[model samples]
Target: MSKVILITGGSSGIGKSVGNFLTKKGYTVFGTSRFPEKYPQSNFPIIRMDVTKPNSVTEAVASVIEKAGRLDVLINNAGVGITGPIEELPDSEIQKNFETNFFGPIRVIKAVLPVMREQQAGLIINVTSIAGYMGLPYRGIYSASKGALELLTEAFRMEISNFNIAMTNVAPGDFATNIASGRYHAPVLENSPYKQAYGNTLKLMDTHVNQGKDPLEMAKAIYKIINTPKPKVHYKVGEFMQKFSVVLKRVLPDKVYEKLLMNHYKL
Candidate 1:
């Protein structure tokens, strides 16, 4: 039987790309969407799931298990983006981000644990971001949310290892996706102290996304990981510099790295 793969947030962006690629590889792929009606043309079926809600997660998992009889892989690709000066961003937006980007993935993972344990063999891939590796200016909340998920995945891996259920976190750099359009952006206030810096930084971030690498790169990387018998705890996919930035933080002194970031962002 073809392996069954379930991807959350598969309606578009990286999730959709990965789902389409896996489908072409002959896998039985199922993608999840909060609004399944919007993606009637999706190659594979899309299950309705709101990772923030427990009931939705339960129903989505049950639907997958019922249709596939088993789930061989799960790609936790559902996430939202948030950007603003830390002090300026509303608490509600931050909470919402953590809900979708951090808690959301955890909710889905918990829902699938029992089923995977029963199978004795399963793979879980958490789609994190390269930003998670470091706290970027004006994107602290996003970085924190993803970083939390990354650490949680590490802890979860140790617990699930004995169950023959493998889990890994894949961090991708900027990919050409609709995330910028959906992400919340705190207005650049005219009289706020951070107006100038925030405005310039926001423009830069958007430019980076606009010129980001193709989503196909992420899709290919994920496909390769799926076929492996033993996947690493973490995988990073992106341009040389974006991936290297993570390494630089490790080797550089604290102040030096901060200076580099400030310089990069022109803070």
Candidate 2:
């Protein structure tokens, strides 16, 4: 049977790439965006969804169920990144990051679980990041968000194993996507104490992101994991990320790993 897949934050970046690729592979792809009208009637039918809002998530799922009848896979790819030293960041910005990056997925999962449980088969692919495994210099908040998602996926996988539902956490390294530009920044950029300390790092972050792996490579890896006879709980998509970040993080000493990441980010 052709898989029916739903993806959040499908308007652009990796989510959009995955949606388009999956539709071409004969899967019925439905992507969610807050502005449903802005999303063209392309291969994937775009539905209005805002992960931070549980009601919006419920409405989106209802609409998808009305049309697709069955949701074979739900890809929690919606997320936002915020940068700054944890010490220098405001409490509100940090909370907002969690709302969009961590709790957003939780809301969508809650909305989709009932239907998937009743159907007795479904897959959930959470688009986490390499940051989930390691702490970075300026992206502490964003990393924390993904770290929460990683733990959530771990528990989700164990709890649903007997129910024929699979949860895979895709931890990709940096990719050539619009994430760097699209991330939200605090309004206190000019007046903040961290402005000088983190401003340059932010510029470097943007530059390095442009040099990252092709997003389509990660999209293909996601597709493969979904189609595998027995899917794994964790899937690392980027070549460099899978080679060094995920594997080394498990074996390397904490100080050594921290030093390596520090050097890479020039912190």
Candidate 3:
């Protein structure tokens, strides 16, 4: 039987691309969306899921297992982007971002762990972001949320390794997606000190995203990860410079790295 794969946020963007690619490769793929009925018809199935809600997550995973009898892969790709100066972002907004970007994966992972443990073999891929590696101006909360998820994936991998389960954190750079349009912009109060800086940085960030790499490239990387035995714990998918920047941050002097980041974002 073909492998059964479940991808969150599969209605669009990177998750959708990955689901379609895997389906073409003969895998039984189910993509999750809060509103599955709204998406255009496709070969793979759409499962209703809202990762933030525990019951929703549980039901979605159960539905997949009921139909497929087994789940070989789980891709935690549902995430949201929030932008603005750290101080200007309201507490509730930050919580909402974390709910979707960090805790959402946690909920899904928890829901699927039991079945995967019983099977004694499964692959879990958490889709993170390059921004997680370094704090980005006007996007600190989003970066922090992804960073938290990355750390959790790293720690969870070690715990689950003995069960014959594999986990990988895939940190992708900017991709040409509708994420920018959906991003929550923190309200900048009139006369807020960071308003101008936030505007300039946000503009630069949007430009970078508009010119970002294609989502298909990320899907290809994910396809390879699914096929490979003993895939690495972490995969960085994006332009050479963006991937290299992660390495540079590790080796470069603190001040130098900070300056480079500031210049890149025009902060």
Candidate 4:
């Protein structure tokens, strides 16, 4: 029997690519997004959902259960990004980001755990980012969100292993996606506290994301991990640069790492 996989934030970017790829591989793919009506009704069905909304998550899961009877895997790929000096961003902006990036995945997991626990088998893949491990300038909020996600996944992995559930966290480096352009940006001009502190740094980081790894490559990496017999707890996907970054983060002193990031982003 074909396995059933559900993906969140499947309307575009890596989520959409994974949905398309998995469906091609014969998995019964059910993707969720707030704008399901915009996604064509096809083999990879798109269901209406907002990760930050509990009701939406519940409804999406219920719909998939009714149709598929069982869900074999879940890809928690739905997330949002916000960039700027932490102090400069409005309190609401930070909360909004955490709500979408962190709590969003939690919501989906809660809605899916019951079925998986009962079946005593399932897999969850969290689409985290390198920023989850190494912090970046003007990205304190983004880092915080993913960092929390990484820790949450760890706790979840430990808690659910006994239930025969597997969890994998994919930490991809910079990818060329709409996430950079689509991020929530707050104006830096008006009397913001950290306007001057983050002005140039934000610009440089934005430029880097504008030209990064291809999103399709990320999608392929995700597909491989999903099909693994015993999926690992974490997978890092990126080019040579990303590997080097990880190494430097571990070997270099704190000041040295900071200097490298400062030079990379021209901070």
Candidate 5:
């Protein structure tokens, strides 16, 4: 039998692309959405799920296992982006960002672990971002949330290795997706001191994302990870500059790297 794969936020963007690609590759793919009925014509099955809700995540995973008899892969790709100066962003907004980008994956991972443990083998992929490696101007919360997930995934790998399960943190740079349109913006009052800087940085961020890589590239990378017997603990996908930034952040002097990042974002 073909492998059964479940992907969150599969109604659109990277998750959708990965689901479609895997389905064509003969895997029984199931994608989750808050409103599954919206995609009645999707090539792969759509499950009703809100990753932020533990009950919703549990029910969705249960439905997949009931129908497929087994789940071989779980893709934690559901995430949200928030932008603004750290001082201006409300505490509630920061929590909301983490709810989706960080805790959402934790909810889904917890729901699937029991089944995967019983099976004694499975693969879990957490779709993080290059922003996870370093703080970004106007996107500090988004970066922090992804960075938190990356660290959690690293620890999770160690915990689950004994069960013969595999986990990978897939970090992609800017991608041409609707994420920017859907991103949350902290309320910028007319009198706010950081308003002009926020606007400039946000505009630049949008420009880079608009010119970013296609989501298909990420899908292909995911396919290879699923097929590999032992995939790397982490995978970075994107153009040269983006991938190199991760390496530079590690090897470059702290002050030099900070200067490079500030210069790149015009901060």
Candidate 6:
């Protein structure tokens, strides 16, 4: 029998692409959405779920088990994007972003572990971000949220290894998707000190997403990882420079890297 896969935020974007690809490859794929009804045209099943809601998470996982009898893979792809001058952004918005990006995956992971443990085999792919590797000009909150997930996976991997279940992180660089339109942008207040710089940085961030690589790249990468016998702790998918930036951060001097980022953002 083919492996059964469940992807949160599978109604659109990278999650949707991955689900479609896996389905075509003969995997029984299910995706979650807050409004599953909206995706009547989805190629795979869409489970009603809100990652931030505990009951919703449990119910979605349960629904998958009820139908599939066993779950082989879980993809934590449901996340939101937040961009703004960190100091200028409201605390509520920052917390909300973490709720979805960080806490949401944790909720789903916790829900599926028991089932995976009983089944004695499973794989989890956390959809993190390349932005998580560094604090970007106006995307500090986004970086922190995804960065937290990366760290969580590091620790969680060892804790769950005894169960024969595997966990990994997949950080993607900018991709051409509705994420730019969906992201929360703190208003550019004219009187604020960061007004000019923040506005320009916001435009740059959007342009990067608008002109970013295709989501298919991410889908193919995820499929390859799924087929691997033992997945690595972390994987990155994107253009050369985007992945290289992580390495650069590791090797470059602190102030020098800061200078490079400042110059790139024209700060």
TM agreement with the true structure for every prediction: 0.99, 0.93, 0.98, 0.94, 0.98, 0.99
lDDT tens digits by residue: candidate 5, 1-267: 899999999999899899999999999999999999999999999999998888999999999999999999999999999999999888998998999999999999999999999999999999999999998888889999999999999999999999999999999998998898888987666898987878778889889889988999999999999999998988999999899999999999999999998887776
- In terms of lDDT, which candidate is stronger, 1 or 2? 1
Please, what are the lDDT tens digits per residue for candidate 4 over residues 1-267?
999999998888888888888888888999887888887754488999988788988999999999999999999999888887776689998999999999999999999999999999999999888888888778888998998999899999988889999998998887777887778876777676666757777676677677888878887887888778898878888878886787789899999899988887765
Name every residue pair that clashes in candidate 1.
none
Tens-digit per-residue lDDT, 13-104, candidate 1: 99999999999999999999999999989999998999999999999999999998999999999999999999999999999999999999
Cα lDDT of model 1 overall?
0.95
Error of 5 at 154 (Å): 0.8
lDDT of 2 at 43: 62
List model 6 lDDT by residue over 204-251, tens digit each.
998999999999999999999999999999999999999999999999
Single out the weakest 10-residue window by summed lDDT for candidate 5: 186-195
Worst 10 residues of 1 by lDDT: 226-235
lDDT-sorted candidate list, best first: 1, 6, 5, 3, 4, 2
Candidate 2: regions farther than 4 A off: 186-196, 241-243
Clashing pairs in 5: none
- Output the lDDT of residue 65, model 6: 94
Q: How many clashes does each candidate structure show, in the order listed?
A: 0, 0, 0, 0, 0, 0
**Is candidate 1 or 5 superior in TM-score?**
1
For model 5, what is the error of residue 51's alpha carbon versus the real structure, in angstroms, after optimal superposition?
A: 1.1
* Shift of residue 54 alpha carbon in model 3, Å: 0.2
- RMSD in angstroms, all models? 0.6, 1.9, 1.0, 1.7, 0.9, 0.6
lDDT of 6: 0.95
RMSD of 6: 0.6
Mind sharing the TM-score for model 6?
0.99
C-alpha lDDT of all candidate models, in order: 0.95, 0.85, 0.92, 0.86, 0.93, 0.95
